[model samples]
Target: MRIIIGSKNPTKWKAVQDVFDTYQVDTLNAPSRVSSQPFSDEETREGAINRALQCAESTPGAIGIGLEGGVMYIKDQLYLCNWGALVTEDENIYTASGARIVLPIDIAEQLKAGSELGDIMDQYTRKEEVRENEGAIGIFTNDSISRRNMFVHVVKLLRGQWEYWINK
Candidate 1:
């Protein structure tokens, strides 16, 4: 099977490829031509589906996959990460959980003010590109925590729980 991934993030691509690597299938990157920015839950899913479908359609008989990660507000708190979707041309779905992080109050307030978390922190701290390296945690302390690691764990569901239609 030819599988296309809809993301330029090496982390996401690696995570997805790792799952299918054991199988006798080929993989390629074809990140969604659509916007990557998160808007709403429904829109985000559509973005993923569209990308996956686009890839699937492009190769005639290939399987397309899409992964999306974004921040969400939960109970007045900022939830930093969550998985999006996995789609096939056959219209199958293999959704998974996303990484989760609790935003500190200061960060939450800044997100509430319609500012991208990293960009907002970049302005207040004036550390010159700290957000890209440190992000939310950069505001307080240096930590090894990263969304990329979190996503790897979440994407591991295909190991046991997922029933692969392509394999079937």
Candidate 2:
């Protein structure tokens, strides 16, 4: 089976590769058609769905996968959130969300002021391209859950759902 990842980011590619190692995986420049930094779980999940649908539309015979990271407010506090989606060849869509962590007030304020989490994280840690590597999740979780690791979990969820549908 051929898998088409709806992103060109290496971290996302690695996450899909980790879960679908036996399959032929390829990346595409699929657009999420959402905010650069999604602000809510609903919006983030929509972005993932958009990307997955776009990938599937562009590559008819392959399964399309999308991964998205964003922040959301839970009980008046901002938290980091991740979401992912998978589109089967038959056009069945599956979605799953990953772990979330509360963000510090300062970061929340910056995000509220229109700063992307990746940029804020880069400045906060003086590290370049944190999103491409460890990501905000890694920094906040102290590497217990790297960004790729979180996405891997979400992708695995999508895979499990897809497998169940196929087998059943």
Candidate 3:
């Protein structure tokens, strides 16, 4: 089976590859059609869905995958949120989201000021393309978990649903 990931970000691509190790994995730069820093779960999930559908349409007879990371405000606290989607050639779509982590006040403020979380994390950590590497989650967690691993977990969830659906 072939899987086409909906982003050029290596981390996301790697996550999908890791989850679906037996498949032929490829990536394309698909548009999310949402803010760089989505402020709500609905917006974030929509972006993932859009990317997945677009990528699936981009390639025939393949599974398209999308992963989107954003921030969400809940109970007056800013939390990091990540969502993932999988769309099959048959147009069956499956989605899963990662665990949310509350952000530091400083980071939250920068995000509220119209800065993307990846860029802000890069600036704060003096790193480049953190999103393509360990990512904000890794930096915050002291590398206990990486951005790739986070998406891998989300992809696993989607895979579980896909397996169940196929079996039924």
Range of the 10 consecutive residues with the lowest summed lDDT in candidate 2:
53-62
- Sum up the clashes in candidate 1: 4
Off by over 4 Å in 1: 23-44, 117-145, 158-168
lDDT of 3 by residue, 30-111 (tens): 9999998889999999999999999889878989888999989899999999999999999999999997888999999988
Task: Please provide, for model 2 over 75-166, each residue's C-alpha lDDT reduced to its tens digit, 9 standing for 90 to 100.
Answer: 98999999999997778999999999999999999999999999999999999999999999899888999999999999999999999989
- TM-score of each model, in listed order: 0.66, 0.98, 0.98
Task: Compute the lDDT for candidate 3.
Answer: 0.92
lDDT of 1 at 118: 55
Winner of 1 and 3 under lDDT: 3
Q: Which candidate leads the pack in lDDT?
A: 2
Comparing 1 with 2 on TM-score, the higher-scoring candidate is 2
Ranking by TM-score: 2, 3, 1
Candidate 1 to truth, TM: 0.66
**Per-residue alpha-carbon lDDT of candidate 1 for residues 61-80, written as tens digits (9 for 90 to 100):** 66666666556667777766
